[model samples]
Target: MKKSITILFCVLLSIPSFAQKTEIIVIGNIHQPVPNYNSDTILTILKSIKPDFLLQEIDSSFFNDDFTFKNPPKENEGLASVQYIHNNPKTKMRPFDFEGRNEYRKINGFNPTEGLAIKLLDSLYKKNKLTKSEAAIYKKYNDLLEPLKIAASKDAKSFNNSSNDKICEERQYYQYHKLLSIMQERSEFSNTYYTKANGEKISYLKGFQLASEFWDLRNQTMAKNILHIAEENPGKRIVVLTGFMHRYFIVRELQKQTENNTNIIIREFYN
Candidate 1:
């Protein structure tokens, strides 16, 4: 028994830590104009990198073996990358994004569009369904976001030096991360998502709370999924291609995780 135990211990010690052995690179992607960055450029870059697995931002629940119900279409950056991999007979590609089915599942069935939700709430306030205070608070919270939204819209409209035209990760980070940070700092807006109205608590933040939670839960899930996959397949190279908007949260969370898990090396695509 002692001899057998010693052999098992030796095997265990020979195995390397997950972090020290694996390479995880997170790349930001552009969505519109299918070939804007130009598919050839994207493909060439990916070919050289040669990732073992490509983790995408898209939800996987939409795809089938037939590829008939493709979620975003092949022109989208994420799908375009997939198309490139398929053309290469030598490359082995595995899909990591499940079409956000996980995010959809985590939401507990509350499906409300951001614009629609806000519009409905505004109408409710108009109809007196919401108290004056609730309406006023809601307005105040949204008012804070108006400036950022306007700035983003204006930046996009210019069609010049707009990250929207390209992944342009650095520019996107510097410009938008602060807005998201501000949103996070104002915890007051989330104080009571819904208040009691006629014995039923109504969500005062309306869809705002749901949307915030959705992104948070989604980012957290993505991080957990990446870590879990890495641990299961030690030394595997994984590249996560997500929309630039998610870069701030995903990178932040992944870096924090690395403090405890020193074995894996997390690298930015730019680096």
Candidate 2:
């Protein structure tokens, strides 16, 4: 029995240790009438990279929804986009699958447009019926965002570059994340998330404080997701397409996971 146990132990020890391998690529601002050149450029780049998996910033839940609905025409544009890509012979040459980072899921929850946060906020307001002050505050928040909304509606490119546009959108993004962070911190619900700062809370009473905290936290979450994915998929190459600001964070996270090993490659696609 002792001899047999020793042999089994040796075999188990020799089974080869696994190390996850992944590559992270960042794509910045790919919207517009910049002609087909930009898309073609991206197509060429993707072809050369030939990544096994293609993770987008889009919410995975949405992707699952598209899959469930058999690519319904109106409800989901992303699915159509994916189908378009996959059907093309030249660009669709690889067996890439769609996945999303934690950031995408988290943001999807917060989006004031057709997301959980807006629904909850509406419910809460309706339940309490919102005191005049509370209603006023909410209205103010909406009003603050109106200018950017109009700008975005008129000319997307101009709005994308406008300082107010960034502030307004980032404000919404931060608030959304902060709300999630608060929920997570409070440990009340599962879908509601807190920011990366672990125990931080977002108090609705204090207009934008929570959002500011959570915005930074989103950066951390993005980094964590990138690193976690890389570590979990040892020896397999994975690619992530996220916001440009996240590129450095993902690279740093990967470096830490690899123990400063220089084997990991990093590239940026932007102006």
Candidate 2 off by > 4 Å: 1-21, 31-33, 36-38, 65-205, 256-263, 268-271
lDDT of predicted model 1: 0.55
Cα lDDT of candidate 2 equals: 0.44
Per-residue C-alpha lDDT of model 2 across residues 56-108, encoded as one tens digit per residue? 54443544533332334231223323544574423211111223434543443
Q: What are the candidates' C-alpha RMSDs? A: 9.6, 13.0
lDDT of 2 at 49: 60
Superposed model 1: Cα runs more than 4 Å off: 1-20, 34-38, 63-72, 87-113, 117-204
Best by TM-score: 1
Give TM-scores for every candidate, taking all chains together and pairing residue i with residue i. Answer: 0.57, 0.42
What lDDT tens digits, residue by residue, belong to model 1 across residues 1-271? 9999999888877776522368887765544543234445456657767776666665545556643236545644565566666765444434455345545533532333334345655665578766555656555555554443333343222222223323333333322343233333444333434423234443324345455556667777788777777777677777776655565567677878877775687875545
